[model samples]
Each structure stands twice: as structure tokens, then as C-alpha cells.
Target: MHKPVLTIFYQFNPWYSTIGGIQTLINTFIKYAPNEFEVRLVGTGSDRTQKVGKWQEAELAGREISFFPLFTLENDNFRSLIPTTLKYAAALVGHSFASDFMHFHRLEPSLAALNWQGEKTLFIHNDIQTQIKAAGDKNAILWRRFPAAYFALESLLVRQFSQVFSCNTDSAQLYRQRYPSMGDRVKYIKNSFDNEIFYPLSRTEREAQRHELAKRLGLSEETRFILFAGRLHPQKDPILLVRAIAALNEPHTHLLIAGDGELAADIRTEIAQLGLSNRVTMLGALPIEDLAQLHRISNVFVLSSAYEGLPLVVLEALASGTPVVTTRCGETPKLLATDNGVVCEVRSPECLADSLQQIILHPENYPSTSCVRAAQPYAARTVMRDVYSGMFTRWEKRTLSIAS
Candidate 1:
């Protein structure tokens, strides 16, 4: 019998990740894991109180996952993540000593499993300091003292892990650029999505759903709804989106802004000041299920954030067969390459509006389903198959060498 494997993740926006790309990877792992290995997953939920108990668990076909949400959003304090991480690490080490491998998504939580010392792999979600640096442009003070701890996972930290899995080549290149000594250790792992949930709906269904949503939202059939489905914050450039929408010369083009954030009020003010109160709809913070429905109803999907780590929203939109336009954030190169989505200049509404106008009018020509299906291979099942096959080959070689 083989020892189990433990997968760890950082779930800052827990609700979003649960329904996003990483969720697809986790769920896929559950669906098609090999019998030789048992897998346990751990995540830090938004609320630390949501940690796993006996009654709370995730049931996959092959294995039952005992999950504990270590730290919650409300409970983030000084070293809270550190101590809570240690507690979970202790639990995994003490009771689940059979775990032979620990795969991590973010830097901090992986530190908790530092002592497990088995085969360790860190997935580069993004360069946190780069994001903070970009965000600092708008809110100078909050990030003025950006913590030194999270600045860059340089040589020392990179060497600590046995392997590194980056979301894209750019992310890996950044790491290699920062820590050339460990350049050979980092690898690329594309995010995945399930085609079943994300594929294009039938024309009839889409038309019907759009009609009903239009009626509910007081939109007419002639109204063209351009969408921005993300947090309304300085980091996302909601004002840029507003300015872009205001610049559109196309008639009947409306902007449906779904999601809420610290900058919601400010973005709303900007919209009003631009005289787009009627043209722009602010559908604040929505459920993931509803967000998908909105995508199905949308003419085009647009993301204008200043930073990202392979944002799953673009994938989700592409999966829904909705034409998309995004900025060259963290992993935009890979995303645009595979999905054929448009890349626009970040924080520039003029560029965004032009892209949006092009996507909306000629959206039918775009291969939306191709974009959705492009994510299938990176699903958990596919990744596990590759990992296990490679591991088995390596193990056999080591055993053969020993026998000789």
C-alpha cells in the first residue's frame, strides 16, 4: 500500500476559488484519483471558524477528504496564519503520518507543512509583491509598508521546496529571474476547467435566459449588455472600466458590472459623473452560480484588472462560450494564446471599450467553445495521470538501481 498525499492551498477569496479554476482541479482530483494513493486536501477559508470537523467533509469517488479550513477571512491577525498552519501541520504529521507528499498552492501555508519534509511542490499563484506594487499606485499608504516576508520567494525559499509548479511560464520566468540558482527546479502547470459546466448553452436556452434576465434587470431586447465580473477595487480599475464604457460610441451598449469591493462607491460615483447611470448596471457581489448565468446571458466578457494570477474568470467566460477581452496581467500571455481572447491595455478604458465593441458586434465569429475546451487537459485527472506515471517510472528506476 502506498502512503497518502496531502494537497494544500491558499484560499484568500475562498468562495470564489471554490467555484473557480482551482476548484475544478480539486474536484477533478476527487473524480479520478489512482487507487494506489489516497489524497487529503487542506485550505484556509475566509473565516477561520469554518475549519473541518468530523461532520464536515468532502466526498470524492475514490477517497474521502478530511478538510480543515485553518484561518478565516475575519480571523487574519499577526502570525495567525503561521500558528494555525502549524496546528494543522501537526495534525497531519501526528495522525496522518502516512502522507508522503505535500503539494501546495501558495507560499505561506506551505510553510506550515515545512516539516513534513516529504516530496514538496509549491504552485506559484502569483508574485504577491508585484501585485502589491501595482496596487500601491492607487492606494499608496496601505502597501507602503508591504511586508518584507511576502516580498519575493527568493533563493532560500525556492530551495526549501523539492519542486515548484507555476501557473504559467511568465510566473516561472519571474521566479527564475529572481532566483537563477533554482531555475531548473520550477515547472509549469496550466489551470484547468470542466467542459461540462462551462460549455456554451444552446441558442434557445441562452436567448430565453437572456430575455428573462433582461426583464428582471429592466433591459430591453435591443439592449447590449457588456459585462465586468470582478471585484470593484483600485486593483481592478473599475474607474477604468467606467471610462471605457463612457467612451463607447456604439448605441444600446450597456455595461453590467457584477461584483462588489472596497471601491464600489467610488466606481459608482465615477459612472454617474460620466453620465452613465442608466447605461451601467452595478449588480453587486453575486453568487458563483448566478455569475455563470450572467455570463451565459452576456454579449461579451471583459476583465480590466491591473494584476492577476491566471484569473479563472476569463477561463469561466471562455468556457461559457462568451467572447472575452482581458488585460495582460500575470498569465495573460498563456491565456490569450490558447483561448484566442483579446488582450487590451490595462487601466486604459479607451482600449477596453474598443475591444469590447469589437467583441460584442462580431462575437459570433469567435470560437468561444474552443476557449472553454482548451482548459480540459489541465484538469486534476489529467495532472494526476501525468504525475503518477512520472513518479512510477522514477520509482522503478531507483528500485532497479538498488537491486543491481
Candidate 2:
């Protein structure tokens, strides 16, 4: 008796080793998916060639999940994506016998998945159009050249899948508006996090972890810290965080930044110009263990992003029992609706400073348990696994009914 096989068509093979929001989701699914269902991944490579590789076995949750690779032409750019989509679509159609249904991680690969003969589900993590607009002249040349074509492709892909899952309500609304025919097919599924790795620590355990982090960062144990963990990019608005911290000028308050990107130098300059060099420490990108420890020890977690698609870090912080002070971005309003943290206006250092000060002055108001409970519904193993299982069952029944 063969298990029901679900084929996930993605742009890249996010084998548990890689680090990203989507990779984390893939890993979580693999770790907790029902035993009765077998999962396989199909993806394209970065190489400038056009060929489909043989199916190979990869491990997920101590079980094997077969991986099929479709080589891309050139740099996986717009010019070469046409051929890549054709090759992958052909390969998927040829291997239709291997999969019961298909899952797509983004619009880029769904174009190919649409050609395959199976039920398809699409997971939309971000609003591409919003991001393109947010990018705002950063890559003017590329945007000018491909904006129209990209929009056409995106519009088509959004309409092709009958089952669409978005991580936030905002994206779901956008999808429904853009493709009214999709109707209730667009769902708002919150992103998940590993509760085992991010759960609240006991006071004793937290004290120990705080000591460890303070020692590692050469800080005094008495120093209260706020943590920010994400890429140091324009979209993330790390500089705004630095500016906010500087405006506060609280002697006992320190800001700990984890993660590195193009804005590292700019952040460093802002810290210096604001004379907050001593108050700020950029720990660069941190390993999962270290990041969890930082969350466990910090008095608060901060996110000053210009935009987002329901950031996993906020959930991670909440799971670790740390209150968050974040700019109103993406699904943050919904996440914080439970009184989990403070919400500030985007790109407003004054507002951010005020929110942080409020949390600081009344730290006891945000209970550790409240923060932890707010995160329970988004646990990686629990919520996301159930969502996938429910969808798979519903899709299976729908397919059977159609066949009958």
C-alpha cells in the first residue's frame, strides 16, 4: 500500500540546511507531516542549462522525500525563466504518475505546476507587487525592463491555482481582489515556528541564558536589552531602529542587532552619528541556537521593517516570551491583536521610541505567559502540519469526487 504522495514544486530545493522563511516552512512540514502522506520536492537549479535530472532521494523527518531537479537556462532571470518553466512543466507532466497532487511555494514555479495534471495548491508568502513598489528605484533598470512582463506572469499564475494559501490577511485580500474568481480559495494561514526551539524559558533558565549572552557580548548582566533579528536591509529598516534607540537615550537600555546585509555600513554610520556606538552592538547574523538565546534573554524584541509578510521572527520572539515593539507591517497588527506587544508607525523613530519606552516603564504588563500563549496557534509542528493535512484530505476528496 503506497502512501499518498504530494509533490511540492519550488524554485529551489530548500533542504532543511538552507535558512529562509520558506525553507523553515518546508523543514517544519517535513518534520511534522502525517506518516500516511509522502512528500516529494521538485525544483530548478541556478545553472545555465535546460535539462531535467533523475529523481533522487533526500531525508526528511527520518523518511525519504524524493527530489527532482530541472536545470534552468542562464541565471534564472526573466530572460531564461521561460525556458526553465517549459522544461520543468514538461518534466512534471512526464512524471505525473509519481505525484498525487502538487504544492507550489511561489508564483515563479506555479507557472510550471499549472501544466501538470494534478490538484495544485499555491502558498503566497508576500505580495510581489508591494515588494516591487517598496523596492522603489533600487533596481530601476531591471524593473523598467521587466515590470510589465512580470505583472502579466504574476497575474496569470495567481489565477491558475484553485487553492491559494497566504501567510497574512493582507496578501489574501490582495489575491482575492486581483483574482475575484479565486474567491474563497485564498486562505490566510499564519506562518509557523519551532516551539521546541523557541519556547519560553523558566526564570532560572532565562537568567542563565542572559548571563551567557551578556558574557558573550561583553555586557553587564544588569543592562536591559532590546533585540532585533532580521536582515539589515532597506525593507527591514534597521537604521530606523538605531535611530529610535538613540532618541530614547536610556542609560540602562541597550540594543542588540542580529543579522547582516547591504545596510551594515549604513547602520554603523548611523550608530556613530547618533553617538550610540556604546549603546548598540551588531552581532551580525546569528545561528539558530544563538538567536533563540538572544530572544530568551532580551527584555523586548524590535522590528522596524518598512514592510513584511508575517515575519517568523516576531513569532519566535513571542514564543520565547519576549514582548515585541514593531512597526505596523504585514500581519503584525493581527499578530499583536492579542496584546502580545506594541505597534508603532512605520519609519517613525519617535513612535518607535515611545512604544519601546512604554514597554520599558511597564515591563510587567506584558506577562511571559501571555506572550507564550499568543504564539501557540502558530507553532510549526502543530498548526502548519494540521493545515497541510486538512488541505491534503480536502483536495484528495475533491479529486475523487471529480473522478467518480
lDDT of each residue in 1-404, candidate 1, tens digit only: 34455554544333333333455455655556566565665655564445543224656544666565543444322223234434444444433322455666645545445556466777766655566677545442233254554455343455777678877677788877777777888778666544445567877898788777777777677776777877565666778878988888888778898876567788878887889988998987676667878877778888787777776677667777777778778785455643346778645777888888777777666665666565556544466778766655654565577689
Model 1, runs deviating above 4 Å: 11-36, 44-57, 60-63, 71-98, 135-153, 337-340, 369-384, 387-404
Model 2 Cα shift for residue 288 (angstroms): 2.3
Report lDDT (Cα) of residue 266, candidate 2: 84
The TM-score between candidate 2 and the true structure equals: 0.83
Identify the leading candidate in terms of lDDT: 2
Clashes of each: 6, 1
